[model samples]
Target chain A: MWKSKAKFLFLLPAVVWVLIFTIFPLIYSLRMSFYNVRIGQGDVFVGLNNFARVFTNEQARSAAFITLKIVVIAVAVELVLGLALAILFNRAMPARGLLRTILTMPLFATPIAIGYLFFTIFYEEGGLINGLIPWKVPWLSDPGLAAISISLVDIWQWTPFCFLVFLAALQGLSEELYEAARIEASSGWQVFRHITLPLIQPTIVIVLLLRLAEALKLFDIPFSLTGGGPGTATQVYSLFTYRTGLRFFDLGFASALSYIMLIVVMIIVSLFFRHLRQIYD
Target chain B: MSRKRKRTKGIIILVLAVAAALWAFMPFYWAISTSLRSPLETFTIAGLGIPFIQFRPTLANWIDQLSIGETQRALLNSTIVAVFSAVIALILGIPAAYALARFRFFAIKNKDITVWFLSQRVLPPVVTVIPFFLMMRSASLLDTRTALVLANVTFILPFVVVIMRQTFADLPVELEESALVDGATHFGILRNISLPLAAPAIAATALIILAFTWNEFLFALTLGSRQAVTIPVHMAGAVDTRGVQFWFMAVRALVAMLPPTLLALFAQRYIVRGLTLGALKG
Candidate 1:
């Protein structure tokens, strides 16, 4: 038998790395959140004031609202579209491999690059959609449309990811398992309805939760697309936090806001994941 | 199934697939077409600016983007940081993954321990970026690739551990247990049997982490701003005084996007197993 002491060695480096980088910083930022941190002037401790401002401030509230809106819309559309595509592709299709490779091209694209790509495409005057049409639509300029545009871009990018994962889940179902189900079923769709859906339900839940977690952290598209402009129209929660801490140098409030973001995400993830854990454990 | 009905179904699938492919291809088409156009010719063409038909495609944007020293430096730095970050993560994480897969710890459940490791990822980078900025600034690592790599390891390590843990768990434990009975050490078994079996997963994980580190922007933008700028940061700075340079931005977007996209395509075969975090594998 190996030394009991040596057993700890394998896990030590990861623990140390997390402590030094992740845990330390999280705690350090927790302290910073209580202070009124600014540029040039020294930090002044103002306990819960930053937290109070996060709740009261119009910008923060609106940013929160907009982020929620985008997350809900984008994730919903991605779910529907992705599931349909995945279900459609579960069959033996011609050139399936090539089609999959092509469809999933946007999955690995830089989000900021998507921001820029869509910027030009949606640029009212000489832009692609406008140039192709007779009307010069204000895609990025209109306040209501900008956030919708952001959701569209997210849908464009992540729908393929959902499709891929769902397809994998569907494809992973063994033929024997399906054959057994098929014996009791009258038609093909009945097999999917009775067997495939139930089997992949866990995967469905996980993918949905994964998409939700990521959607909550939305930053890149809005940051590059509008730069939180047209009067903070598309300024998401992350972008607002970035501007508060980095650009505005109000580190304390940003810290508090980020903490709140962290806590909210943790709560959401745990609530969702508790049910999922039973499937694996 | 009737032959006519099956044939119609195939045709429908083909048409739908082609339509989906076009939607997928639209962005690349726009970016590449934009990159090839001169400023004067950008809006002149009809029907999404078909090159050579409406206007001659120019290499000026590519030449302009590539000739910049910052572009070259950013490319080099991103390569260095991504490669080093991926390697360090694999080194630190694979051992832990193996341990989790094989050993039952004294106190903590392996499940709980695994969850703790995964929780590190759930903490958004923004939550950690501020303190990291302060810390990096104090340590004088603000503009170094080392700092970027370290910060990257914080997030990427969990992926390696969780995915590789699943990979190792999937591997037949019989061979390892038999090897142990034959007087092989646990480390020896991992080295000779577990690692070789898990090599494809390892390679796949490394490539994914590499692509991620390469495409990373937030930390690189904050921590490695000047001297250690990455492709994403460089691509972000593609704008000039005359508003956003669509052509140049297109060129830069293509440059930054091509590597990760190609790397992901190469790794796509493993992605079904690798990325689902073993949820489907069960």
Candidate 2:
């Protein structure tokens, strides 16, 4: 009994921390969503008005769509590129470890730094991309290009993460399967499609889910790069929420916006988990 | 035919790998090169257009940024906040991790607790930022390093707990059992036996947490105004206030990247394992 009590005591600090920081804030934010909160003013209960504003507000709606678009497009491209890199590097090559180390350098870089680096790289006249290419393109000025540019930065920083995960998964694969395929004179494509793909499917799903979650909360890149700028061209959902809550001091509306984001993420994550369970079963 | 085809394929793969490495590393090289260039060189098309080999390198930007008080203060604040928050989280989290790893509890399943902890990490920071902002404001802790530390603890604690829990679980139980038979208390066993065993993992976990806290922008931006501004926040401020000082921005970015990059170089093996939360072995 004492041992069990000691175990509970051991867990107490983390539990209390969660209760105070995470759980309480979640509840408080939920409550704040229903109030008309402004700076230097009392939070007046407004009963669903803030949530309605979230739906009615054009910026918020557009931001939601843009966030989804970036997440999907970026994650998909990253998976393909990362998988290709992983496959290429999975086999023995000279300086393989050194190459991998360099590849992963981007993964640990400060996102804000990446944003600033890319900000310079995508500059209209003096940018690296423009300097390298013949024709001048407005990278951050044009709306479509700005969005693509931001996604590209994300892809650059994160593809290595996917690559590393996939490499690990590939290395873990059994050698016997490949030997059997070789004995049968199976083509490379057929062997890969039948064996490698199925074997690494779980890691693929895990990487996708991780990337989707992180990408959905995208802010630092857009915040630092364009400041959601050239208009609201690159203003993602989190940045929109930030502007609403902190910049504008409309806590009520911001809380609502946050809740909407929360719901969307929760739904997506749960769906992924269900799929993951299905795969296991 | 097969040997020739295989050679061709290998060559193509090698070429592609070289291309991918250049793609990954070019921007970082640009950042360093830009940081080393004089402001005149940075602004002029001739200097900015080409790679580092084409330019007269200078340390003017690095000198200017380091001399600035705000940049120094921000770097100091970042180090303090990151180090302290990581320490605090590890202090509180390690024992809990051990408890979860070793002991089966009455009502709560270990898996449930772990999932709950990880879920805290997954929830978007914006969801928690509003209330935290208000709470800090009311408590008169806003813009203070304490506020940043507390907020960082919220996110990083779970990661520490999760990683350490997995580390503890992977450790063999017989050592602790033998210690118990020797009349060592649970705490004693954890301190003397489990801690030494898990030291490498702990170091890796701490470095990762430090990196996360140092690189964290959203919470720092929201919770800190001036007094607690971190390196990332300082970089953002330079972007906003200074406006396209490419050389200066590059210097700041490089300074900001130093800790995590160095840590990564030292702890690359553990980082791969820690990142995957031990689900995939390095």
Give per-candidate clash totals.
0, 0
Model 2 C-alpha lDDT per residue in residues A164-269, reported as the tens digit of each score: 9899889988899899988999898998899999999978887887778878999999998888887997899999998899889888899999999898788766
DockQ of 2: 0.56
Q: Mark the regions of model 2 whose C-alpha exceeds 4 Å error after superposition.
A: A1-3, A271-281, B1-4, B43-52
Per candidate, chain B TM-score? Answer: 0.93, 0.94
Tell me the docking grade of candidate 1.
Answer: medium
In angstroms, the error of model 1 at A66 is: 0.6
User: Which model scores highest in DockQ?
Assistant: 1
**Which runs in model 1 stand beyond 4 Å of their true positions?**
A1-4, A38-42, A174-196, A275-281, B240-242
TM-score of 1: 0.94
Clashing pairs in 2: none
Candidate 1's residue-wise lDDT over A189-241, tens digit each?
88877788899887788888878887898988888787766799889999999
> Model 2 - which docking category?
medium
| Candidate 1 lDDT, B227-264, residue by residue in tens | 98898887776553346778888888888888888888
